[model samples]
Target: MFKSILVPFDGSQGAEAALAKAAELARLCGAELTLLTVYRHHSLLEASMHMVRPDEPADLDDIMRTHAKEVAERGRALAAESGIPAPRAFVKGGPVARTITSFAKEHGNDLTVIGSRGLGSLEGVLLGSVSHKVTSLSETPVLVV
Candidate 1:
């Protein structure tokens, strides 16, 4: 019954499971699947600043964008090969939960699929869990795979 399904991926195994589930659901329902990958811009910048020497120059935004694009490409390819219709790829820079919720609202997606991980209990309390946040905050139905 879903017209549009949004699947968020991060090149992790958990994300792969979510993508597979979303692809199957899309195929079964003849729905359009959208593969979303949110690049944690702030985190990446902080990481770059910590890893790189102060004197060294680095384009943190560009680097993170490239990585996000690659992750999206991989997810898109997998969905396409699995018989999901031409999956659209999106890359955003923000907190994962906010980005996902905003995308689902903006796209009018019937369903949002995301993997559970990355944010453990301690991390969830600190940074928050993307999947849990989306599930609790999203207006649309969210399936954590």
Candidate 2:
């Protein structure tokens, strides 16, 4: 039985499906649940694309972090609604697969339940999906929904 379960969520339908599965497992095992949302670091060019003002320089990291936090919190709320009590949420900026695996290891999570697909870039489609990379990299077992 899993004692700690991690779910990497991206606010997509696939992620929601994974979350539902993870929540059920958590409830069954009486495990602690954590919802993780990872956002990529924005380069200056990418940041400029999202800038609100033409001349104003916004802190892209902060902007992205805030949005990521919201995504995590939403996932936590969904878990709670699914009867998973007090689910924890975390947001980080990094390569999606690496960040998820690192967080699971760092937090001593016993299992990871993730979506088959997420809001991945074209590069991910060309190379491999984030879920695929996570499954390959993680020592803990990964269940792809």
Candidate 3:
């Protein structure tokens, strides 16, 4: 039985499906459910590529982090609605799959549940889905929904 379950959420339909499944498992096992939303860190170099504008976000990383926080909260709400009263949620910026695995390891998660496909860029399609990469990289057991 899983004591702790981690779900990597990205505001995608696939991710929402994974969250629902993970929450169901957590409830069945009476496990603690954790949600994480990771945003891609945009370096200054990448920021410079975009045309500067007064209305545009001055710091892309900050904007990304802000959006990530919203996504995390939404996931938390979903988990709460699913039966877990108060699920823990977090927001981070980094390489998505690596960050997820690292967070799971750091937090001593027994199970990681993720979506088979998510809101990934073309790179994901070219290389592999985040779930695929996480399955390959993670030492903990991963369940892809």
Best by TM-score: 3
State the lDDT of candidate 1 residue by residue for 1-145, as single tens digits.
9999999888888899999999999989999999899886656557567466776546677888998999999999999999876799999988778898899899999999899874234657786677888898899899998
Which candidate order results from sorting by lDDT in descending order? 2, 3, 1
> Candidate 1: where is the Cα deviation over 4 Å?
43-57, 118-122, 125-127
Worst 10 residues of 2 by lDDT: 49-58
Root-mean-square deviation per candidate = 2.7, 1.9, 1.4
Comparison by TM-score, 1 against 3, better one: 3
Instruction: Using TM-score, rank the candidates from best to worst.
Output: 3, 2, 1
In angstroms, how far off is 92's CA in candidate 2?
A: 0.8
Q: What local lDDT score does residue 59 receive in model 3, on the 0 to 100 scale? A: 82
Q: TM-score for each prediction?
A: 0.87, 0.93, 0.94
Cα error, candidate 1, residue 56 (Å): 4.1
> What's model 3's lDDT at 24?
89
Query: Candidates 1 and 3: which is better by lDDT?
Result: 3
Which tens-of-lDDT digit does each residue in 1-145 have in candidate 3?
9999999999999999999999989989999999999999886777776665556767888888898999999999989998996899999888999999999999999999999989989999899899999999999999999
